[model samples]
Target: MENSVIKFHHCEKDIYCFFVPEQCPVCGESLSSRRLQEAPVSIPSPFVNGQKIKCSFLVKPTKGTFLREYDGRSDLHVGITNTKGVVYNYNETGVCRDEQGWAQSVSVPLVQPDMYSLINQWDPYLEQFSLAEMWNPQRYNETDHNCYTYALTFINCVLATQGKRNLTKTEFTEKFVLPRTKKASRYITLYQEISENYFYIVDSSQQEDDNSSI
Candidate 1:
């Protein structure tokens, strides 16, 4: 596949594409791209590992040819891929109807930790969902399904409040270091200093003269 030229289908949506490697392209973090493809049902990396942002929404089949069927199961699975390249999966059950189509839905979630802060900025009382269903199994049986109605939108908002979004090492230290030092105060003396280009921490064992900038 590496040697083969890749093609993308034109999407009206502004899509961000990434070329994932054997390891995290950023932060030099070790990753297993191979494992994802090899799994019986491939679970994307961001979902299983460190910090990921996610959101889910439902989709109803309104027009023609909006539904699909699988060979073995009476149910269907709703899945989505986020900007960070993680995939979220939900299993749904549905039944076919005589008319007005089947009431089916898909929950679409995105993995964007920064979005939580932005969402709160928009609405303080917005409902937060913990787990979401992406597909309906009732309408997924033998016949064609259409005109689905999605119930909710769930997003993982915890990551944002926990300060897991985009951050530099310096910024992270400034935001989280003080509290850590305070909590460890009983065990050791933690002195800290920050300058325009230097930041350092001193232990109780360090002599005053030994404490100096890098």
Candidate 2:
């Protein structure tokens, strides 16, 4: 999914990243047209003391627009991005890189910026783990040992290198992965309802705005 939050100046600029919301969330200014960002690519980092850091990310296609172009099992092909954003994934063709298409991704930023050596070694470690014998193409299973398996295992390897606890399938899914998918699902549902009815007002008397996000 695209970024839903942004910084806005009272005076607009020249380029926009996503859909122009009716009003600016920051200044409460009405946006008739050209709700642009002056520095669209200069988004400030929220991690590592506001410095841009290379992070490992989990990626999956969010939803198809008109034509549903995706995997054969009607399931998404999951991939892990290296420090350079090169997507590595397993398929019938075995461990590969840069093959998976664009996806909605969530970054795994457990590694701190201070661990420079470990951060620098992410790519090689990931490459070594991905090439292991268990990830052979003939061993691939659409249901059982598949791309998701490769992603989790590789992540655990990286964690082990950093002397951290390996996340169980339950922990990884519940803690990191599912939360994002579920929240995105909620926003999509909300957007659809608003499109159909022009509004989706919540019961403010009973329940406050759902301020929490994944």
Candidate 3:
């Protein structure tokens, strides 16, 4: 069965508060309260000097219009973030680095602190893989051995080091990749839905705060 997306309402400062049908999850109260329960402790690390350190796997819609012609459909790009918050994604050009964005992401809890090292080690290999693909179109099929596969390979390698069984391509796509991509797509749709409605006005006062964080 397909996974269902979690429903939430935008709260103060754009924080998402989970909802259960007509009721709020926190306070066991009505949704009108708008007060959130203490934010769940983050998975990566607790706030250090008021800064949250996070390492995650992100599934972002491909940027720009140029590459869309290749697949004739919107494609998802998968990447992993380092503890330093840098994102590493494999693309036609090779592995690219960028700062984290407000995209769909899943926290990847490190079994050991050294797992971060394992992620970094894949960078060179991914670059090599991409280079080989550039020389041969058949090396990486757009639908099969693409960015999603690249990210999955890296994730499976990390899991293997932790004595966990590696995930098959089908298992990885069905269990992790597809679910996260669907959630991200739904989030974009929900945001547009809310934006078109007149009742859910965002406070202009928080614009600066939001931009700064981004």
lDDT of 3 by residue, 39-98 (tens): 322112110210122345665457532111213256556666555656766666556666
The residue-by-residue lDDT of candidate 1 on 1-214, one tens digit each, is 0111111111111111222344432234453534332321221211121113223322322232122331222333232223332333332333221222223332234334566555443222222121322235543333333211222121324345555564443553355433432332321111111111121223323423554211
Model 1, stretches more than 4 Å misplaced? 1-3, 6-77, 80-86, 92-214
TM-score of each: 0.18, 0.63, 0.49
Relative to the true structure, how large is the alpha-carbon lDDT of every model?
A: 0.28, 0.57, 0.47
- For residues 1-214, write the lDDT of model 2, one tens digit per residue: 3333222233432222234457654456776645443433332322121112245555444344211232322455567766776777788889878633444344455467688887788888888888789999999988889888888887788778668889988998888877655665554544444445543334332222455321
- Best model per TM-score: 2
Judging by TM-score, tell me the better candidate of 1 and 2.
2
> Which candidate number maximizes lDDT?
2
Q: RMSD in angstroms, candidate 2? A: 8.1
Give candidate 3 misplaced runs (Cα > 4 Å). 1-54, 64-73, 100-140, 199-214
Model 2, stretches more than 4 Å misplaced? 1-54, 62-74, 206-214
